[model samples]
Target: MLVLVGLLFPLLGCGGPKEIIVKGKVTYDGQPVDNGQIIFIPKGEGKVSAGPITNGEFNFAAPPGEMEVKITATKELAKAAKDGLPNYVSYIPKKYNDETSLTATVEDKAENTINFDLEK
Candidate 1:
């Protein structure tokens, strides 16, 4: 029984899923994006991760594998008001979000820099 207990100890203390750090920049029409959110959804079965875009940059830890990327940006809240209603508009095209055409491969111990240059 003592030997059995020792073998089970390692299994019981096993950690959870593996993850890696990812970072990149967002540019629109040749200039850095102002504000937005970036999301990474694993191609297979895995948890999704997100990061906030600030000054055209974003970074976060995510699972290591193939992931579909989605980006969304809009004008400032004060600048988006129209007809007394919040008219949040995205500067990025739908092909980069709902119909994302962006993909990235994340690996361990490597510089994971994924940059996107969008057009208006």
Candidate 2:
């Protein structure tokens, strides 16, 4: 019975899912950005996940480790501007057509909170 109990202890010590909490805010012109998508691209891996934006804030959990990530924010609210015309209706530049990108690193057993300020 003692041997069996010792074996059970090792099983209980097994590691569970390792996760890292990532949180951040997005702002443009000093204003909270809403309805934008934040993408995380892991180093050497094509896996990606879209983080949702709520009230200019976002949070996500990823496997605990060092990771190279790129964040982006899209201008969804400014789609339709004056005269019911799309903001990028004509002469849209490649950079302005999508979200702005930033590169950052996530450390192990750490909570990373970052803020991205986009330009108009």
Candidate 3:
């Protein structure tokens, strides 16, 4: 029916929100983070985005919103591994990852860049 077709036409054009590219840097104790990952959790109903932090920087596409960020970095202890003990060590403080208090607001725009300087 013509009426039915008209109603469905607009619905076809409706897609989800556009994801903006978000880029940033990460540091610990004034030094660049060697390697890690950054996660962005939306404050409201939305999808999450994540990216790897390599050499103190990372970039990923995320929906615009208020995001709670969590950053984690770790290293493997060669000595401990050879001794058959726990070999993994997390140099970053718990406050930056487990109990993260970091927040960033990303507006819907053409570009966004944020940086996190963490301390142990």
lDDT of each: 0.87, 0.61, 0.89
User: Over the stretch 54-119, how does candidate 2's per-residue lDDT look in tens digits?
Assistant: 778989876544444444444534658777865542222234324324555666757978677655
| TM-scores of the models, in the order given | 0.83, 0.57, 0.86
Q: Tell me the tens digit of each residue's lDDT in model 1 across 1-120.
A: 999999999999777887788898999889888889999999989999999998999989998999999999887466546577776777788988999899888887655888888875
Q: Could you tell which candidate, 1 or 3, scores higher by lDDT?
A: 3
Q: TM-score of model 1 relative to the true fold?
A: 0.83
In angstroms, how far off is 48's CA in candidate 3?
1.6
Question: How close to the true structure is residue 32 of candidate 1, measured as C-alpha lDDT?
Answer: 88
Those runs of model 1 whose alpha carbons end farther than 4 Å from true positions after fitting are: 1-4, 77-87
lDDT of 3 at 46: 88
Indicate which candidate wins on lDDT.
3
Cα lDDT tens digits for candidate 3, 1-120: 999999999999978777989998899999988889999999988888899999999999999999999899987776777668868888888888789999988889987999998876
